[model samples]
Target: MPNSANLGHKKKVFDLFAQKVLVVVGKGGTGRTTVARVLAELGTKTGRRVAVIAGTSGTHFLAKEDPLLSFSSLEPGQVLISYLYEHGLGQLGKRLSSTGLASIISTAIPGIADLLVLAKIKQMERSDAADLIIFDAPASGHFLRLIATPKGLADIAAAGPLRKQSREVLEMLDDPTRLGVAFVTIAEETPVKESIETMKQLKKSSGIVPCALFINSVLPSIPGNEKVQDLSFLESTSPYYQAAKYMRTRSQSQKHYEAMAAKAFGLKPIEVPLVPTVELSEDDITYLADIVELQIRSKK
Candidate 1:
């Protein structure tokens, strides 16, 4: 049901290796997390030291205890949270004061020390190691604020170790070779519009362009032919014929909507089909990986 006019146009969604850091953004319930996980897996498959991190308080939900999961059958170092209060504070204290003095203060005021440590952890995560770091950032509206945190903290600290750390983060954010943002959305009106707006804001605020737009749950356009007509007719004999017809119609409508949304946003949309279930098994993930690999191969 996609616009027949836009059927064969190719989009680049998987050619992301050129980017050092990639942030995926989208409206809620648009499969942003799924896409982020896939990209992280792909990065790891290529033997890159990849780190996946959630950008908000919701990190606990996405990654419970072991924040990282291996996808390529190879076990790697665990992914650590970028906001560990105690450990971060310890590192900051070591940088700020002598080991003996910092240790004494840390013991005396553990609560305050932990709070300071947490901030430093976030700063280090934003600017440190790993060939590819994937950030499952907050939804579009709040993602911008998260990205702006370094600048905010920099201004607050002014002239201390915190300021220097924040500056490093800001520098990483501004470097094109160090960062890229991905916008994910469904083939729906509101999400698509929000994605466009998010892109505009991202460019204005960060001066970094999004490398791709992922159109999650895209309905493929099946050409009207004898086969489709036969399938359409076969539904007439069933009690649920009406439901079948509705599904077919809905699919077509969704396709057209996605096409228009992609055109309006001026982004080459990468289509990911809708699956029947919410919980994707390893086989399902493999199927998706194959699809993505095909898309990447086609681009080449």
Candidate 2:
């Protein structure tokens, strides 16, 4: 049996997992997939059923054998077919797809593919298919359009199933308790700038802001009082000394950008340190998850 304090901590830790949907987006190469994977793994630690749905990528990097964590990726063509079937247009969907007309149709209708994909996610939420659904979205620019599709359609359609579906999705976007959005960025000028701009666009387009921002691959500072100037003589003779100086310089640079990001987003960013590994092992993910759990716990 757990003590009162232990139980309370557990509840606080899992409060983030209580959200029905979490959407992650970032500039390419910022490790949005890694964050999604870690979130899914953490949710399973508490016996929650978690699934990661990829918008433009595959979920093969996730733990395939984990019973509590399921994975899926969305292909527009397939989603459109299934969506048509669900909405009573199976025959037409089949005819268009079989003759390669589906691509043309999708291109002709802006946001149709996005709407269909969102409809599938909406269905999964309604049917209780998973306790937590994490959507690994495309690059931030594309994601802005993906999320804005529902409202655009709703505004244009006066009365129809299309309008009804659009309104439902908009409701999900507006509900913070049901849906949480997070952005990831590296400690660099371009990514930091793009993240701020994209976040502002999301707010302008939907009146919704990200719940959290994560700064990935932050260099950990080494403890030392010895200045690089004091070690200049050794740096001329030793590669090891040169490497240390480079890292110290890089770490300082990262801090500069990290502070800029925090001020622009108006949220203290969660920093995931750069792991010293050629390939991330399970332990590395667990270590990062511990950071996320502690951060959430502190807030609670």
TM-score of each: 0.68, 0.85
Expressed as tens digits, the lDDT of each residue in 61-120 for candidate 2 is 746578899989875566765666766766665655542555665666656666667767
Backbone clashes (count) for model 1: 3
Residue-level lDDT for 1 in candidate 1: 22
CA lDDT scores, all candidates in order: 0.57, 0.73
The candidate maximizing lDDT is: 2
In candidate 1, stretches whose alpha carbon ends up further than 4 angstroms from where it belongs are: 1-14, 56-129, 146-160, 220-244
Count of steric clashes across candidates, in order: 3, 0
Q: Please state the error at residue 137 of candidate 1 in Å.
A: 0.8
